[model samples]
Target: MTHPPSAHDAPWWRHAVIYQVYPRSFADATGDGVGDLPGITSRLPYLAGLGVDAVWISPFYRSPMADAGYDVADYRDVDPVFGTLEDADALLQRAHDLGIRVIVDLVPNHTSDEHAWFEQALAAAPGSAERERYVFRDGRGDGSEPPNNWKSIFGGIAWTRVIEPDGTPGQWYLHLFDSKQPDLNWRNPEVVEEFHDILRFWLDRGVDGFRVDVAHSLVKDAALPDWEARAVMAGADDEPVVHGDLGPMWDQEEVHEIYRGWREVLDSYNPEGDPQRDRILCAEAWLPTQERTMAYVRPDEMHQAFNFHYLQAPWRAADQQRIVETSLEAAEAVGAPTTWVLSNHDVVRHASRLGLPVGQPRPNGIAAGDPQPNAVLGLRRARAATAMMLALPGSAYLYNGEELGLPDHTALPAHVRADPAFHRTQGEETGRDGCRVPMPWVAGEPSFGFGAPDDVDTWLPQPLLYGSLSADRQEGVAGSTLELYRTLLRLRREHDLGVGGLEWLTALEGMPLPEGVVAFTNAREDGPVVTVLTNFGEVPVVLPEGREVLVASGRLHRDGDGRRTLHQDCTVWLG
Candidate 1:
């Protein structure tokens, strides 16, 4: 029905890029000031034109709107606010028609309290089957304490009292996120069966695959020891005692058992290397160590997971390079491919993170108190980061407005925000809302290029800088960051950037590794091995030797026989 390109023409994973669209703010077609499935369907052509291989839609499933759709009350039906099931079918079909695959989000860790199953269990009598659906325990028998002392990531205690079906007043249940989302008792066989059915419902829906949310939290310690009572005594700050263990037991052998079962099921849907219908299972996990991170990507666990080390690392080439190398090494050791990510819904935008002023009170881009050290070397830094990301040997994920050089804190107010983590950590640390504000489409619109120009207000306020920070305005200007993204993506596909044999070569301090400049070469048998040099500094950096420039941040340079000069932040390609 569609005519983009045959599946065989392009390998499912090779030479392909994924573009993430946050459904709530992509576009508001209904004029209700919120985006929906129809709004996303209407924007299909634009995404296809952008030359991405797939679209990963953040959860649009039915829920109480807690955590922005992650708390699912129903798996088979679409949220009315987003659209009907028919609209979902249409959206998937339209994306496929444009040679773009559609990947939906799946959250199996917990369920909304409003779900019929949870409600039934909440009312069932003690010792009933329904009561077993969640982690229910008898509370403070006579003079006893809670099952465990695990503190909630949001703040205080993780346990909430819920009356038993027997009308007992002292029963409690565990919830990791909110009381609104109660954690499921995976120890129960029926609970596992119900979730497996949930997975199959989507698998049968013609969707390309899924991005599994919080895959590791499904299993917990059955002992349920009160964490605070343990000898570990992690209680050091104003906060409650931290959980004591994070060893193999922390992952629970049962966790691997569950994932291996899911992998068997995914295999039934699409066997390995099946191009026409590939079933991908990417996970979102956060752990402190590399060994812990690997548990999520074993051969039978997740196909890939986002690399967060870089996202949290301090902005420095040495720091970033080590993170990148370590991630790649760990993935290879596990015999699984890696997914490179620089930005996501949960982190500050790279531009804001790179260029924020220190000790300044500037709202928007104003110099508030004093400027924090953001990457003052703007355009060049952006170009270098892009080259580094794209040249890596794996799938690359991109956020919506990153290509347009969209700056953060443009106009998002402190109020009208929804991230609990940000609100919880205010003053001490900020959450990721600054980067999630509405996109600037046209510079002329009073709504700052996001909502309709004639409309009184947009869903998210159109920041005042909308006039200058827009994709439309930058599209007309040569060498704009927006243009650079388009061109670089094209070159990636046309020139085969990371396809064949390639090796990384580094120059140490004593060996002419010019200050703030990094040079490396890719070996190719059929053609000239490409040599790339990047400059993250402000001034032009001189090259080592025998290097010719092909592409720069703002302009392209030529060898002119032997010596090469690269402007700051720009990258030069040579063959």
Candidate 2:
């Protein structure tokens, strides 16, 4: 997965702009009020128009609808709710025909409680091979207590005691997530062999790659030692805990061996002798430090890990600058490209997030009664932040609807929420359903054109304000968020910004620039130089001379002398 130094030799993912589609919320072609693979196929044109190089579809595997498909009941088949396996094949073909690669989400850490293996484990006696496939263990103390002090990532105890087939309280199984998802025993030889076959099954179906879900959780401390007693984090996107402070259940050392095996499976596909043809494995590893993050992207392991450090950084000038510098440096150390992202299905959208007063702790979810963010200011900063993110030197990921400046459905009611985090925490946490609402494609249409025009149903309710921000309303509109994204993506490709070299313009020929302005220049070998300037302060500032304005998040103000001034919360690209 090494990215060649020269842009010509680099793998497509090194500079690709990949878009994520949460299938259940992407589109509803079946009119079942839920999205499906066929819906994604029908929307390929929209993605092509959005200018992303690839599409990363979230889990649509056979499941019981617990944790929204993260709990896999079958690895080799598509869930009926998301259409059939045939529909998935059609999506792959259509995306490739449009010059787009498809990266399917792979959940290997755990399986649904109803999965065949788990059911078999329930029927088998304790200490049997069937039960050994999962993390099943005897209860502690009086056989009523959990095996360890660990808490589930969603909430509650990490271990769920299962009733034996003989009708007695039996072994407790580990489920770092919801009780419905039982963690696999990766150390088991049979479990390892099963995942290898799963990888080959999808690769044979022509998927370009996989976004490994919970990539760091496959392996755990063999000792199964009790962790320090601590409260479970409300949501999964909390800031990374340092290695020494981390619990034994996450980011274990043995995980690297598993990925190294998966890498071999990917390399086997490059029969054309071109490393670029090898399928990619992008890890969803929320690790401690930059160095630990880089380890996942080394040549023998994953091609990229989500740059969560950048995603979680505060919307401050100094913090963003430092994160960008450290992210680039850390990835460079391993000869891998940095993968930048703003918002995803797991966290609050950056629009509403950055709109909050600076330095306020990011909430798990924003409900109808929660203090709201200023929509105008939020969209402005979201656009500016996205522009800056695209100008950086690495691959970038765009969650669906982000190009439309969509904010969280902050007013969504608790009754309609389906995220496991929300229910597990007894509604104290708002959960991620707000960020997973069906996208609004057409203005003034039923379900905002998410389904048939007459169909008023959606899996999750939409907000009334979605009408004005629908894709149809923003397309072709000047200075609209959708158009700005199209422009930014276009310029990024034309300037080779994804594979370019970046350096901070800390000072022009040793002269300092304005405070609260983060500026940098990106130049690829044998490519044009593009400068990006973002103003995060309250004041406007003049741009450097001899650079022509290419695009901006907002309108540039003109001073009395006719010089263009970059205003607050604006980001501009100069050529």
Q: After superposition on all CA atoms, what RMSD does each candidate show versus the true structure?
A: 6.0, 2.3
Best by TM-score: 2
Backbone clashes, each candidate: 23, 0
Off by over 4 Å in 2: 1-6, 229-244, 452-456, 508-511, 544-546
lDDT for each of the candidates? 0.64, 0.87
Judge candidate 2 against the unseen true structure and give its global Cα lDDT, from 0 to 1. Answer: 0.87
TM-score of each: 0.85, 0.96
